[model samples]
Target: MAMAALTAATTTATAAHVHGLCSSSSGFNGRKLSVALPRVCAPATSKRKRAGGVAVAKYGEKSIYFDLEDISNTTGAWDLYGSDTPSPYNPLQSKFFETFAKPFTKRGLLLKFLLLAGGGGLVYAGSNATGDILPIVRGPQQPPVLGPREKL
Candidate 1:
């Protein structure tokens, strides 16, 4: 009963097409660089939900998520995702491949591994400090998927 009205809203969802080449560091650690200069927009969405449509996405500093918005005259549903943070189609993350997520593409594998391993060791520890069962957090955060919020 509650889901029908939410479905009435219209739709079209896709990845954004942000412009600007990610310039490389001149030296190993050159002067500071920039991505999309912050333009004013509504405060970015924080908590995720599914009031109208089942939208699931993730956000990054430079638009790596999906965007949904409202049409001026439509009397239907709005379809969107993520923080609408603005990002173009990632060449690295196609349907079949994600070999070079932004971090890796920018910082290489060795550095990323060292950082993660070092951080995790300090945080999680080698031996099980607590005896109770625990779930290992998969990895770097992906957009939270809010939904049927049900169990399988």
Candidate 2:
């Protein structure tokens, strides 16, 4: 009974001491977090191409839909790219792309996994308190050089 009373008293004292120090509402509760940078691309007039019996733009590994008639009707569209007609593809480039481009795409999962494992190992070694662990796992140390004091 005494132990329960002491715990209750301590809890009440801690609560009272921390009263008014915390606010239930924060200013950032209603704000949104934006994680992407602004999108940038080439101008629309210089991005159209007519190939494989369709008017489309080369978007990554696939051709995307485009409106050639709309582009033709637009005033001053002919002034773009010095003549406004789509450029012709080189035969050698097209042959190489058709032969061996789809088989090799970039993959970085293994590199990311190795980096994550190394970071986790460093964190585990730092947090575990035992004998000397600095010699086996350590990073370069640069001593902080103090400069003259500021007058602020």
Candidate 3:
């Protein structure tokens, strides 16, 4: 399992660049015209191809280019975005995915299992302790609040 996770995290990925140029017309025609930079590729969204990351761009009305690149630079995980807000990183899902993508050695598998079990146990224990410290099962009428407080 560990080997698999490692292998997966270290797989080849893809990246893309998105940018656009501008064109304008001038009036009165006196040293007038339009200027724009040569289309330079913008910062890209990169991720592993297996993770379902693809790049798509449209140039002319009838010409649209779409392809994937080799972008192994990204680790942990990544998601594609089409707007200003990038996608949130989902660690839990990515962990499961990375596990199968890579080949794992026996030792690696053992370590992974141990770590996951230990972490999960710790989290559960901590949650239980928290519950014990504050026995508040929030409900519609309960009006959950921290500490002891009478209704105002």
Candidate 4:
């Protein structure tokens, strides 16, 4: 969906540019324009063809052209591990909370509690430290009234 929108925008901008309706200095109605067009980093090759018969611009292995079909075909995971098996530590899995709580269940209770308490204490201390540096507002002092037996 995003690719389609981008492609449509690029085509529209290219058309406008060709017709002299839009430019970097001035766009429609003499307004300044800042349309970002994709830059072609490499020369065109026959191997880099889109389903719509358009030659896509390439930056290394990636394609600059957008295609909706490509979105559904891939899992969107980077091949960091370079293996067929998925990584053991998947935060999005259903057992994520279980895995995360496994360590806290058996050991390090005191350390974790101390860390949490220390974090809270640091926050409170920071507020108190800043209070001394901030300015204090004072109201006008009233004049002292003299009593029958009192002398200045």
Candidate 5:
């Protein structure tokens, strides 16, 4: 009896909703279910104003205006970083490479040779240790047979 009343109320609510009317129906747990109707709203007006090619926007009581034509043209902009002039310090033009090259004097020659030889020895020792500890198989391996195969 309760189920029949609920079904009738749901049908009436659905019919009213289909005819563009807001209605309510009792849900399965006896809670009211509301149907929303479409509402008509007016279009919003722009708060911005234009004079010549410049656009002005108002924020609260303060108004700010900027020229649209000068936005893309950076000729009148200030040179903050001085990008037009050449920089005083350049990495490629500096004397940084001279330190790595062998000098005419024999000073520090032995130290440089010892450092290079020690680095190469350490790399070789690391490669051998890694290969021994983690032995990996390289190249194609034979696949395991799952079932008895017929003589082909």
Candidate 6:
């Protein structure tokens, strides 16, 4: 991913579009650079059954692993991927992406990723059978009544 820098001193260039992660070095003096931004694309309204299914999607400095099942159902499915926290065990949520935009200022960055869950009961309508408009004209209506010819 590409990273671009923008100076806050200049009022004309207020925002900068970075392809990947944005950190403190991403901005100039006085300007504050933000890291990955959260972007939720879960269906605004859905009646689908939530389960223990988890999905992970990454974009720029943000790595999202969310599941509608975890939010809706009582399955108690937990997600601990791509976290900065360390664990005593070897298996722990690690930081896949990081952005240090600034120690104090946190702005000027955006990260977007979409996660869509299976929709609720889908209504599939049967296709209507349209009668053929033209009559079957290629083949003869009746089979040829062949007669056994005598030996020539």
lDDT of each: 0.49, 0.59, 0.52, 0.67, 0.60, 0.42
Clashing pairs in 5: none
Colliding residue pairs in candidate 2: none
Model 1, runs deviating above 4 Å: 1-93, 99-102, 108-113, 126-152
Better of 1 and 5 by lDDT: 5
- Lowest summed lDDT over 10 consecutive residues: which window, candidate 4? 131-140
Question: Would you give me the overall lDDT of model 3?
Answer: 0.52
Q: On a 0 to 100 scale, what is the lDDT of residue 33 in model 2?
A: 29
> Using alpha carbons, what is the TM-score of model 4?
0.21
Please provide, for model 2 over 57-148, each residue's C-alpha lDDT reduced to its tens digit, 9 standing for 90 to 100. Answer: 67334553454556655344656648755548888888889667543342565566678899999999878866555754655366556667
Per TM-score, the best of the predicted structures is 4
| lDDT per residue as tens, model 3, 1-152 | 99987564443111111222111223234332332324668676575356566786664345533323424332312554245664476878787777875545477877898899999999998877744354345334565476657544
Model 5, 1-152: lDDT tens digits are 99998788777656656633433434346555565535668776675565567566663334534455565343445655457766587767556655655362466887788888999999999877743353244433555455556432
By summed lDDT, the worst window of 10 consecutive residues in model 2 runs over 30-39
- Superposition TM-score, candidate 6 onto the true structure: 0.13
TM of each candidate vs. truth = 0.17, 0.17, 0.20, 0.21, 0.18, 0.13
Superposing all C-alpha atoms, what RMSD in Å does each candidate have to the true structure? 35.8, 24.4, 29.3, 20.0, 18.4, 31.8
Residue 28 CA error for candidate 6 (Å)? 3.4
Q: Mind giving the per-residue lDDT tens digits that candidate 4 earns over 33-139?
A: 66667677886587785667767668335653455557533535456647887667866774878877676776588578779999999999897774445334343
Q: Which consecutive 10 residues in model 1 have the weakest lDDT in total?
A: 9-18
Candidate 6 lDDT, 25-121, residue by residue in tens:
4544655564443465888667876888678666324563455545634334356435667565533223322224332243322221111111211
Better of 4 and 6 by TM-score: 4
1-152 per-residue lDDT for model 1 (tens digits): 55764343211011111223224433346753442433559865886664897665655446444434433223344444246664577754563356445456565776978888999897777474764445454443565566685532
